[model samples]
Target: GHEHSLTGHKQRGTVLLRKMEISVAEADKRTGKNTVNMQETYTVYLIETRPAESVPEGGTPAAPDTLWRRYSEFELLRTYLLVTYPYIIIPPLPEKRAEFVWHKLSADNLDPDFVERRRVGLENFLLRVASHPVLSNDKIVFLFLTEVMNNLEYFIFFPETQIIALKIQTRFISAVFSRRFMGLKHYSDELNTIILQLLRVRARVADRVYGVYKVHGNYGRVFSEWSAIEKEMGDGLQSAGHHMDTYAAAIDDILEEEEHYADQLKEYLFYTDSVRSVCRKHELIQYELEMAAQDLTYKKQQKEELATGAVRIFSLKGMTSKLFGQESQEQREGRIAALEQSIQEGEEAIKEKDAECQEFVQKAWTDIERFKEQKDKDLREALISYAIMQISMCKKGIQVWSNAKECFNKM
Candidate 1:
């Protein structure tokens, strides 16, 4: 019944932020002594979760469950997801601190604009996790959305046995998909590099655009001042100044919207790391498999030496035997028996590892395909939305200046 309920919720659950509040709290500076040496201001977002099933017609709607979560709590949740699902590209949290910031923009994390953007980013991260077929059904994730826990400490406290089991499972899976995994790694790395370059160029362009918009504000002030000195043309000059001011004010909203698009790009940039993580896991598995195979071969060689009574050239075991005098027939037979047992066990281990590797490759590749499809769809929509926004911004600029031209004609 619990599994059925969880499945139903996973199929239709929705997560959203209703609002955020900023508050100051005393924090220990960790300077050896236990004392609150700093007052830190942080945001607390109000998360709201609606029922999975729709309300019946003419029936009272179910009240959504609500809880407050700090940004640090979000970080904790994301970290757990990253650890638990190394193969899935866990959605990235918003930047904890702004980077590549424009000189004109405030870099303070507490700044209202920055906090608001983070709020949106946090909501998007939760929605992404909630919508994932596999991630959505996670017990911890479900609890996170619906439970009113004060802290997420329990979520991170997995049993040692479970962790070991997970590590072993991942290790086995990674061993068989070397070539394809390497290809995925290379592609992700290249894409990450290109996105970083694009973001850098965008920041520089935004700085210039900011300056250009401020120049229009200056032009507006000049026109308004000139209007004060004019006779018949004064009203027209004042009207033009108002149009210029409106155009100048539009840039802030435009740039803020552009930053949203930039965040979308950064999501993929972070995704590359997750992709490389899978590649690294695969390499580790392959390395483990190779070592096991090599050990088995060495064991077989030992068995051969014991059976044939011949020592391979420059062998340390052979040299030790020669220095200490050869074993008696009984001792020799015991050594051969031990070697034979070890070789048998080694063969069985190799077979098990091979089977595990094959299973892992199949599961991993299937997940990778699903991830690729989601990535393509998301990227296509983001790019198209960005293009449309740019076109709309240009149209607005044209309309503003044209209105100013009409004001001049009226004069």
Candidate 2:
């Protein structure tokens, strides 16, 4: 899951440290024995170890559980002996571990040189086992060894290999749910386990093979073959995983868009409802104001009619008597003045109300347009961003898939 660039450094470091420790032990042992020279051997071992430390740690960290202290020259010696040990003397019984090793060695389908070496190792190992008194009659050991060798041969001969076989296993899971291969319709737990095991082995071997190829700088037939296998499995695994990731991302984007749109729609609905409510209230207010204006007009008309009637009565009175006519004239003038002032005030009040209504109508139109424009801009930007993101994602996927395909072809 994490980056692994520094892994090479760590492995080389551990190996060198082991070599140093072995040298120290050997030097100490020789010192105690008096016949051995530590000076020449120690310097040679140190020289052999110099370049190992030069390999800097790359990007990855060493495993936490790994015990570097446990690695020693003795361990390396032991491994070398184990590798070559079968040829020297086979155990009383066919060693299960040795069989596993031979299986891996044979699985390479490597050159004749390697094949010949492995054949010699196995034959000698078998001979050693047959020479053992306790293992001479053990048919089970022979059968197991034969099966191991056969599988190794099969693996080597196979044209393609899956690396994620270890992950395809089915266990004691509920029958309601199951995982199956792309073409397979039925479930077989045993087959799944085997698949997963093979994948693990494939991954391990591929890493080692790649390392060797890189170090040797030979990119010919063998490198190409191994690379092809790496590509095949890597693509298969990545494809299976990538599809889900892409789909999930797309779904998330859609949901986010939906939520944003829903929020805007909600706001739009709110404003629309407000506008409708205001319009209804405005209509009601307009109707009431109109009724009030009509009432005021009627009142003014009634007042004017009374004033005219009074003036006519005063004129008739003045015709009958001069003193009474003078007093009635003054009264009529005052009444006319009061009625004009009242009418003027009423007209001014009506004008103010009309101006307020007009302002409100203008504001409502402007606000609606502003909100619509803002929403349009936001939607446009969102769509553009989404389109760009989709394009980028597609490009990335294509590149990854192509790289995987190329790897497989080379392998």
Per-model lDDT: 0.72, 0.36
Q: Write the per-residue lDDT of candidate 1 for residues 1-411, one digit (tens) a residue.
A: 000112322334434221211111211121222127565556677777665454668987576677777777888887678667656667677788876565677888778777776776776677767766677667787677768886798767766754664576454453455778879878888988988987888788888878878998998999999999999999999999999899899888878777777777777787777777667656765766788899999888877878888987578878888899888999989988998888889888888877767766776677688778767776677778778877887787789789999999999
TM per candidate comes to 0.83, 0.29
**Predicted model with the maximum lDDT:** 1
Error of 2 at 196 (Å): 52
lDDT value, residue 317 of candidate 2: 55
Clashing pairs in 1: none
Per-residue lDDT of model 2, residues 340-395, tens digit only: 78788778877876776566556534543543454355435544554565466457
With candidate 1 superimposed using the best TM-score fit, by how many Å does residue 144's alpha carbon deviate from the native? 2.0
Clash totals for all candidate models: 0, 4
Per-residue lDDT value at 235 in model 1: 98
In candidate 1 the C-alpha lDDT for residue 369 amounts to: 86
